[model samples]
Target: MNKEYLIRWIKAAGIRAIKTMAQTAVATIGTTAAMSEVNWVMVASTAGLAGIMSLLTSIAGLPELKV
Candidate 1:
């Protein structure tokens, strides 16, 4: 329940989310490159979802700070 611990956890979650987003982006790009037919809408949706998830996770993790 320490504030520092909570901050660390939040930071870790943010970092993890960012990392996941990067990984997903790379995978999608690679797949699209290999497959001539890529869905722009799907890619946009995926990126948006990933960003939302990252923000949500970061926010949720903030509660641990008890601030």
Candidate 2:
């Protein structure tokens, strides 16, 4: 692949990662008082889902809205 394509993929992945982490953190930490208790499996699953979504969007492009 070209450098530009690689860069796009990296950017997409990073964005997805950050979004996933934020959502997971809020869900886990916002409702609980225990800061030390965290679910690693749930975090990993969220990351994986984010990665897959980003990859799919990058490859297929986003759908256009219809008026």
How well does each candidate superpose onto the true structure, as a TM-score? 0.58, 0.49
For candidate 1, which ten residues in a row score worst on lDDT?
58-67
Task: Pick the TM-score winner.
Answer: 1
Error at 24, model 2, angstroms:
0.4
Q: What is the alpha-carbon lDDT for the whole of candidate 1?
A: 0.72
Clashing pairs in 2: none
lDDT of 2 at 23: 75
Candidate 1 lDDT, tens digit per residue, 1-67? 7878867886777777777777777778778878987777767677667967877767655554444
RMSD per model, one decimal:
4.8, 5.6
Q: What is the C-alpha lDDT profile of model 2 across 1-58, one tens digit per residue? A: 6777667666765676577667765675544436566666765676567656665665
Q: How many backbone clashes does candidate 2 have?
A: 0
lDDT of 2: 0.61
